[model samples]
Target chain A: MVEKKGLSYWLSHAGLILGVIVIGFPIWLAFVASTVTQSEIVSPPMPLLPGGEFITNYKEALFSGINAPVALMLLNSTIMALGIALGKIFISLLSAFAIVYFRFPGRQLFFWMIFLTLMLPIEVRIVPSYGVVAQFGMLNSYSGLIFPLIASATATFLFRQFFLTIPNELTEAARVDGAGPVRFFFDIILPMSKTNIAALFVILFIYGWNQFLWPLLITTDPSMNTIVMGIKQMFPSGDDNANWPVIMATSLLAMVPPVLIVIFMQKFFVRGLIESEK
Target chain B: MRRTVIFKGWKLPILLLLPQLTITALFFFYPAGQAIWESLFIPDPFGLKSQFVGTGNFEFLLSDRYYRNSFRTTAVFSISVTFLSMGIALYLAVLADRLIKGAGIYSSLLIWPYAVAPAIAGVLWLFMFNTRVGVVSWYIGLLGYDWNHVLNQGEAMGLVVLASSWGRISYNFLFFLAGLQAIPKSVIEAAAIDGAKFWRRFRTIVIPLLSPITFFLLVVNIVYAFFETFGVIHTITSGGPQQATTTLVYKVFSDGFVGQDLGSSAAQSVILLFVVGLLTVIQFKFIERKVHY
Candidate 1:
């Protein structure tokens, strides 16, 4: 019995080790590919460790005008991401507060309408959305990119869920003390839901930074392109002999912001996922 | 007094919903409605003049060989990827849950891929799969297979599936892990005390309890596989190798953006929306009811 139990334990441990390797190998390969020169990557026996072309690859990637300059693209991505994050958080907070703290006609109907949008994938509306942005004369502009993404049904849903869990007595007390709805929400509700807000902020920031298709279709001018579009433009379609080193380098640069955000806000990120489950 | 109080209460709700409503109307509903309207009219790209054809676009799509293949490709890809990734994720989540140490490290490491955007992830995969410089190509050649995703349809589909699954597994793992943690320890302990084996305990207790999360993840994973793969497909394959990898969304983007067939693209969009909406309603109605919570 002891031997059988020991065997099962070892089997489970071995399976886990294998699983980790399977998950980790691709990421390791990505990093390795980024470091190596093009020839080393395609060599008969692929280089198992970092190669020597890191700096040269990165410099070429940064300076290449395949898209906008890499630095400018990064800057555009940052502004767009920050704008959308702030806009989404503020809008969601207000929407959640009204729904939770106030009683009004058609409230349920309005809430459901917004909730249903969460089910509507952006792909279905890409063409018409492109037309709308074009019609508004906001094409190739940051406002066009940011405005469409600012109203997030998922953020509102998350905030509403979090707000519903806050004690109503505090808001009632504020109201009795002659506090207006805005004042009550700002002073009481927002403070109580800080964790949820932080989590949503990080999530939305990542989403906005990583956005590709809509921005690609809507923004015609390379100057307004985000990091994602820049990375894509690095390797022109049907170019068999495209520079792999530069492509990898640009991809690495595009990956920087989200990786930093995730690593820095790792605590809030995990908390957000765990809390959302509840 | 009642009327005055009611009016005052409404002011807050109205203010809160105003920005969201306006944005949604302008960006989402208006565009969607326009797309639906455009689907009924064929347009000349050079002239930008549209003429109403009334179901002509839909009829053309229904009869088109390319459209039929794209529909099949999307259905097969979404279903296959969702099941494969979700199945593996559940297994990994169960394994990780049973670990006595380094659970946090395991969890965080598993989630690393999710941090990268789909476009970035596609580039990373493309870097590793390029016929000239790709490490995977080197390995494939070593194994005696002439594998170029660019030229081969089957390889292209496989690469897309592989990339999508690799990117998606982390989310499923996270959700499943959460669901596993939610199951009460005492119930598992009781089952153990009753001499129930691991498989039995999992089948009778854990599976039933985690069904809701599983179902939620299923719906989400399906939706993602259908819509979210556009970036990856566009980047890696560009719906190439004789249009073998062109899923429905890719077709929409190509037809509308590249082919400049806005009317047909809009018709396709309406069909996709209807199909997804119907599926979602059916899923919720049937599967959600079976959920314990």
Candidate 2:
């Protein structure tokens, strides 16, 4: 807390400025490339500023792309992200509520089962999981894309942690009001869980939006490609040229929604991150 | 973990839990159980008949050159990305901490990258460093270094690691900044009064206090590098110039999906299962301590 406003102060400012530039450089270049011609990008040292072809490039990418249109991919990504976020939150909420409020036969067993899911991320178990989904004929479908990915340990864990912190007195008070468990949950717990839900929503939305490998493996159909996975497909195979401007545009489009969420709902996102960790 | 609450039910609670349980059984438990079951059997690539070879896949993986190299490569990549990202993040965080004003701005600028997917990050980095047309590669060439990740193994590894670290820097930075800001200024002021310089005060007081977060981040970052960087490696190199960038997770996909080596891939998955389990336990315990410490 020493307020020495001489060399050290300026140095710190300079350091952060430098850090910001270094961190932002790649994205900035990508943005510039997105707005430029392929010739500009393919030639050495593409112009470092935004070009006149911004509308043309993005229009080309979103309307008609290499394999599937970027527009379709964006929609796919939206559906998948929203589905995963809402689905995970929905199941986790009910499960957490059930585990926390009820003392029933096999309650502990069920809770442990949900807890067990926390460790086996899809990356670890993708092959068999893919097979299981395929057996159910869910591959390339939204159900296959979303359902297999929705069993989140942390979301339920966060909700469980949250439910534990709610006073038992609330339940007792609801009981005194002649309310049943379901009635009490709908009337009280869900309302009180607004902040936690919002926070978790922010984090889960980002997590869902950013999933790449699962979508890549599951959606063999080009029409079903999520924007995140679809970007990888934009690269032409073998010696054929990569459409850099379109790819860059698609990349930017893919990042926009999630990045906007993080920026706008930063407070909730941070709270969600910290609380979920706990 | 128990709640001293009032609700007592077998039917409604069970009903409420059924959906989650069903999904878990169908998706998580069944698949995981199947992975373990399949790991013991070597099914032919044609998916017709299978022979039971208990622990054969594990033994083969341990002895197999590609698998061993993947494990080693994964270790090297994990350590590099974890340290490189965390180190730069800590530096930026410290610098931001020094500023009484504009720290929030720096934070806001830095943290948005947390939203960027690892695959997209890889593309951005690859675009910049792609030998023929890459801007950075051109600049580096001007500096007399031929930066071709296509043919160069080390360069390929470095690109994926950099791409992975770039997106991760934001997450680590957020935690580090939070951790840095949490340290009491009174302690630092006292150190300064005792004639301790900035670096000395930071070395003695700040670092010791920040160790809990650093340790927590270490575990999180390693888990990230091990599993989550699949996208980064996939996009940039596709486990590249002679499998140079193929970490453990990438190898799982490459062998299982690409090569269709079901038994061997299942074995690798089982091994990753243990790694994740161990990390989760450590993370859970450390999280408890984090709450305490």
Candidate 3:
């Protein structure tokens, strides 16, 4: 019933185009606001298109922000995000390897313990977790930002599931080759898990970069602020004026790294999301 | 699903498991237990000692008008966000699936918003609807609707929910699209040959096939609305206009951190823990059912 230039074809295209526009409109508006001057944005009906103040607003935001330089915040966010992603991947790989490949006491107990973490997201235990972190003198440091967040049950479980699918013959062959567990993991399992690790990295990096309440609660120091949480700090309290252009610029900057990662690494990202949830 | 061949070592395995276990105990179990513990007592104003109150904090929370209002607000906000985001995502996914070509381009464009942090989404939405300078509000004013989220409670709730749902649309869209693509073409062809129209075939066949993904998204979006919308509420309204937009998570934050009511906050956390536990159980059970299918 369908023709080359049919009503259904045109209608589907029209609907899809509308969906794309609606989805992209907010980002587009934010981009325009970032490019315009403060006065232009403060007045009603801010310019819908980009303005001449792009470099000025961005430079100001990067060099001297309301509390701390946006550059420093970006650095802090980068450090935290990378730290969490790598730390989680490293630990999850080790634990999953241990659980799957080795016979050990409390294996089931440890597995169950990790699974229990899935229910207790940081949001649920935020207050006491803050207490625990503070009691350890970790507040406002990179470790405070990174350590508590890196205990990822999801990542560990994903790796554990992957490890189970590995054929038994491979491990048997490795042992027959006089290779011990360490050598086998390094030479075989590690190399094979490269794609999964890369995929998980994409997912975890976004997770780390997007962390809000945790970073907000722990990092009281302006210099320790992540770009994501740092944007909120720029808001003017009470009657003071807000520099909308710079604040918008900061928002744009906060989105750039993760957005780029998602766009460029769409394959790995989609795989990581769907598979991890599964 | 244990592996057949295995390594025979206790030391190395323990070593490998050490870091994950230690972090989990310190961060996950310890704080969770502490939340349960602290929920049972009222701390002194000086923060030195806590008096055992049993369920006093929970009683206080249940009787508190503001706390009850927060519970209602969270219910409404999350339900709105879940339906709005999922509905739009499903529509887009259906259209994209109908296309034989260029679906990838639309999918790519739509999905990047998933990468935008929820707080940033809030800031962007706030800018667009800022009472004085927001472009959208200015247009709404042109249409003679006073659009001040600053002063209006409902508008504040709407704005935060919209912002929260904006980023989530991408996530739901991806899953729905994948679900749609996985349905067999032969099934649809068979239905069409039986004289079923597009809508009829869709209702009778496609939607049933897609139910698993839909159910999964429901739980995920609800969980997201509960916990992840904290950043949105904090940035957009600070749960403001007289706490009209405060979700339970937001209440815990404001009470525990800002109000310094640790006992009440801890009690709220315990309630939330149970809520999460219930949702997790449902999700795992549903997953087990799906595996059988």
Q: What is the TM-score of each candidate against the true structure?
A: 0.92, 0.98, 0.98
Clashing pairs for predicted structure model 2, backbone only: none
lDDT (Cα, 0-100) at B75 in candidate 1: 83
Question: Where is the poorest 10-residue window by lDDT in model 3 chain B?
Answer: B1-10
- DockQ of the candidate models in sequence: 0.51, 0.80, 0.78
Error of 3 at B56 (Å): 1.0
The sequence of per-residue lDDT tens digits that candidate 1 reaches over residues A152-199 is 487887787676666556656776778776676678777888888898
Question: Which ranking of candidates, highest lDDT first?
Answer: 3, 2, 1
Backbone clashes in each candidate structure, one number apiece?
A: 0, 0, 0
lDDT of 2 by residue, B129-244 (tens): 98889999999999999999999999999999899999999999999999999999888888899999988998999899999989989999999999888999999999978988
lDDT of 3 by residue, B122-222 (tens): 99999888888899999999999999999999899999989999999999999999999999888888888888988998899989999999999999999
Could you tell me which 10 consecutive residues in candidate 1 chain B have the lowest summed lDDT? B1-10
| Candidate 3 docking classification | medium
The lDDT per prediction is: 0.79, 0.91, 0.92
Instruction: Report the alpha-carbon TM-score of model 3 versus the true structure.
Output: 0.98
Runs with alpha carbons beyond 4 Å of true place in candidate 3? A1-4
